[model samples]
Target: MQNDIIKCGLTEQTDSQFVDSIEKEAYVWYEKNWKHDDYEHSHHRSQLTFVEEGYQYFHIDQKIYLVPQNHIIWIPSGKLHKITSEAQTVNLMVFLFKSVFKDDFYRDLQVFAVSAVLKEMLLYASKWSQSVTEDEEQDIFFKAILKSLPNFCKESNFLEIPVPKDERLIPVCHYINVNFKYNLDIDSLAEKGKMSVRSLQRIFKNETGITLQKYHQLIRILKSIELIDTKQYTLSQIAYLVGYQSLSAFTSSYFSIMKSKPKINKK
Candidate 1:
């Protein structure tokens, strides 16, 4: 218990100096079929996590992100989040104290692409001992990494899966998740939630940071990606399978969300 506490940046007090004070640190875990089910919590520092082997699910601020392998997940300081995984995974979590960043530090959850160079750097950082040595070479190395973070972020729309905190919206979100293939609209969702269209619109937009219609589209897009991975569904088939009646419309929406056209491989 004490070891876990100290590793997680919690500390006890001592006479002259505080025990377990950390500036920057990293911890890596390799697990087979690992799963964590913890309530939402916050940290005093920002965190960058690399999913090396399998995917991870992060619930933050009533939104869920499916961070797949070889991706990076950034949770800014004080943001409430919880993580869970159901597959064999290797996760490297690097915690950077707020003091390390000078200004314009990220304040929200961000999932972005990780470059090969950045991946190597994170791997090396994770190998550092608990008691990091204060050396000039280490200082230069960490400084370079801090300066490179913003550039590492992929300039693309992330999958912010809706998980509303409002009790009224929970059932609505679930319905949309399961029935994304159906033609869903604000009115349908409003009716399902027993609220006026305008009221539902306001609440959904406020809680999810997206309109009801757009959120539905995002759900379909995420589902389409999963289907695409099977290598069985043609682009047109996937389009209709995820609720897009028109092939052209589905292609446009897929391209808009994925920033690329859907590829159908011929086997």
Candidate 2:
């Protein structure tokens, strides 16, 4: 019993150090899997993050990104971001880049669909102990993969929802999130939050950079992604669960955001 307690203490210490290193932007953090909760930090080097098993959410550039499995998220250097997940085990792979590549694509955040080719390339590159290698052959292979990212990752994902900056709209946003599995109209949402329709529409758009209707759609679709990842329900059931009366509406919303068909992202 004492040994178990000591081991847990050590784990907590390691996790704390991990956050410190990341905050200083001095670490090249990559592993086959990690058991962690939502924490905010940044890195000196750019990152290519993919989830092989479970889904995770990222709060970046004041937007909430739902990164379901099989999707790749590109984070540029010095971007303050926080990651969160509810899955018991999140099997993720992160590739850190010490040197910035010469591409405008590398300058901003992009979460895109991971092609089979890109997935194999990322997995193969994961063998390296260091992201910046000195071995001539390995360096050449790595450069090749880096150069090919733009070609392989052309489809831009739309899973991003802007985070609210207005304090007044917090409860309103919460109401939409909590009741996303129902037909939530703007008038009712405004009434629930004790705001006029005009004020609610204007403030929501200003703070979140999206209208209340769009925000509602995003929340519902985001919930559906989580439900789909569980693999416990059928697509029809998932659509209904997320408050879509018809599977067609759910599919349309999902494809609009994810740029792909809904399926479990497993090889």
Candidate 3:
């Protein structure tokens, strides 16, 4: 076990024990730069992961969620999850809540956008060391974050892509992810799966709960979000890079999923 791992309040074991056994009601881990290679585990405490810089890929329940900067990920207690650190360095902060109030936020894994206020609060909370025991002042502060946490989840839910369990569509999913930059018509995609268009669509929808076309668009939009953060490409260039022919078409699709105009974050 590396000293940094222990310093960050994470048990050396990837698969954390799920017993009723958290020492405190709440605690925090910050300045966590250690990388876990597809660390799949679940524990008794609900966890919140925030990135101070860079993004990470979190695989939860056979789905892939990308947590970019200004976003947060919530993993409910006992939900099996894996964190795949990207090749780039990621500054991650994780908080565990052993005792939580009854709320829908803690029931499922989600990656959502948060307001600047909430981000600042979390950054401030990171000042406490992981070794710090339960204290009244710290407990009250965590309670306040928990109370306002729900309000911070004010974004749409199109950020994640469900991993298809069907053996037939597994290769198909991989193809789409790698070839998203090119124009992907249904006919070719169906051919790639070695099935008829109708059968492919049915299985794709059944496994992912999203239509083939919609899933394709969702991938493009997710890619565009990453491009947007780079501050290097214009909207038109990003749209073109992500397989869209025109800016308006890309904007329409992004707005439909995100429920807002594309606003570039200057920070």
Task: Look at candidate 1 and tell me the lDDT of residue 121.
Answer: 85
Task: Give the RMSD in angstroms, all C-alphas superposed, for model 2.
Answer: 5.2
Q: Candidate 3: give the clashing pairs.
A: none
Candidate 2 to truth, TM:
0.82
Q: lDDT tens string, model 2, 144-184?
A: 76678788776564678787877778888888899998776
State each model's CA lDDT, in order: 0.68, 0.71, 0.76
Q: What is the model-wide C-alpha lDDT for candidate 3?
A: 0.76
| Candidates' RMSD to native | 5.5, 5.2, 3.2
Query: Residue-pair clashes per candidate, as listed?
Result: 0, 0, 0
Global CA lDDT computed for model 1: 0.68
Residue lDDT tens for model 1, 140-187: 666777678888887544566777778999878889999999988667
Q: Estimate the TM-score for candidate 3.
A: 0.84
Sorting all predicted structures by lDDT, with the top scorer first, yields 3, 2, 1
1 against 2, candidate with superior lDDT? 2
Q: Give the best candidate by lDDT.
A: 3
